[model samples]
Target: MLIAHRKKRNLWPSEVYRVKFIDEAIITVQSGDGGRGCVSFRREKFIPRGGPDGGDGGKGGDVILEASSQKRTLYFFRYRKDFKAKNGAGGQGKRKAGKHGDDLVLEIPPGTVIGDADTGQVIKDLTKPGEKYIIAKGGRGGRGNARFKTSTNRAPRFAQPGESGEILKLKLELKLLADVGIIGLPNAGKSTLISAISSAHPKTGSYPFTTLVPNLGVVKTDWGEPFVVADIPGLIEGAHKGAGLGIRFLRHIERTRILIHLIDSSSIDPADPLMSYKTINKELEMYNKELAKKSQIVVLNKIDMPDAKKAVDIFQAFAKGIKIILISALTGEGIDNLKSKIVQSLDKLDKLDE
Candidate 1:
């Protein structure tokens, strides 16, 4: 039921396309069946009553899923629900082996996790680019009559049948991979901050829940390394219980190593500036305890507003020990400082891992 809008520019004019962002899909995949073996005997003029000369059957095709960086969403799987590979060819009578069936390779986006549709068990996690996993294996080829040419059964007429292919009902789930994830409530200047630092141009509006889907952007700093960032949807109270869009998009940020907790300075109440901050943290903890324990950088956005300074003072007083960075995403204030801090944090994390 989630709708996403994409703008397409053709040769004539710019047109808007309504595309749905599908993160989960259920599909049925089937591999090819092996070919049958042949049954024949050689009858030549020079040689009388020759042995069996039938050829073996060809192998069936396999169903393979490959991960690629080009794909962003699972939109293609929405229309295509069933996939079937080509069947193998039958054996010949001239002792020639049959050709093997071609493999059906499906290209999917990185960070895709495949699982069993019925059991809900994870099959494989395709996180890196060019990662390949075999979802369904092909059947083995059948033996020919020539293979049965023993001492007693020299002219055996019977041939073995081909094996049946595997069929599976699979589920595909996509999670966006990024180094940092920006999370906050609606209208918290998350879209603005990402636009100011990265090349991603997400749609920004004054209303809440403007970002229907997650947006990814590559942020390059002066340190000569670029990292990816994901802008997740806003979360509200009781989001873990499916109250708002949080339950739908919260999984997208689970893979991120760090998080930027953006809070709107203008919307914060002077009496309780820390209430909004605590609410978002509580939602994260309710959903996943490990996620709430990740490293976070608190940022107070929209500092250029009239009531922003008063709210910032109240929040600073409440969060005395915690480090809070104040920035105006609209006017590019303290943006460079934020970027530098992010790079420094990432470097420190890498060193710690080593």
Candidate 2:
């Protein structure tokens, strides 16, 4: 059982590591049922032949799903799968209508795709903040004896019963929505770079974690809108073949407009500096041709290490057509320049799109 802490503020990148990262879930939901109507008649002393005065039944409550920006995962539905709205109150005597049932609202993270569990069809795509949709509507209230009373039959004996609510099985899948995605092989300084760029504080080691989850961060700018960046983890030699949780991480970056291909200078081989780069790109092309065609910003990190400059020079010589940025992420050398370049690239893409 995965427990999700739905906090008041947005989750910092550090908390993501401690908590289990869940992107998919299945649950059941139900709407409220209508209340039954009451049966009564006017039996006053002055009115010997009083007409029927029964009240109408109240309407049932609806089950609503609301998208919230505060949430980042479908962990809310981990434990409590079943949800039901309040049933409407029954109608009372003396033409008193019953109380309406309350609405049930469920908050989910933005970029969540809702699907019908039984039919396997997409129900709705909640990509924007505060987006809402009525997954199931409550049943209508039944009529009362007074409403059924006619000229010939002044006193109806019985009242109508309440209607049943709707029942549905739902499937939820979450995809990260970010303007920029950082991709690289293990120990490519991705975690360190993301931590430097954003508020993410992922574990930085010599490729320690067996399953490193993706970390998301927001880069605030002095000008223009704030853009989101995600550190996509788990891309290996055979990522397209679902090697080592690679496919899962690959899909997360599909929505990104630009990709930051971070390369470790120390890991580069002077004989074949482009080996790693070509391997990663080949995997991307195999998985999805469009992913390979997406815009990329090649960055060479860890220039402070020994032989790093030599390897970078070799890569620069071989990869003449492409431009690359050299930086030492630990020493913060050329970080600001890298950020400006990212912003510039994004701005250019935006202009071309316009």
lDDT of 2 by residue, 251-290 (tens): 7789888898988899888778899899889989999999
Deviation (Å) of 40 in candidate 1: 63
How far is each candidate from the true structure, as Cα RMSD in Å? 11.3, 11.2
lDDT per residue, candidate 1, 1-354, as tens digits?
Answer: 133322211332311211112257899999988888889888789998888988888888999999975555565687899998877777888786677777899888888889999999999989887899988888877788999998987899988787888999999997535778999998998988889998678989997877767777768678745667888778999999987675677787897879999999888887777888999999999999989999999999999999788889988998889999999999999999999989888888876865
Model 2 regions lying over 4 Å from their true place: 1-176, 208-211
In angstroms, the error of model 2 at 67 is: 15
Question: How does model 1 fare in lDDT?
Answer: 0.83
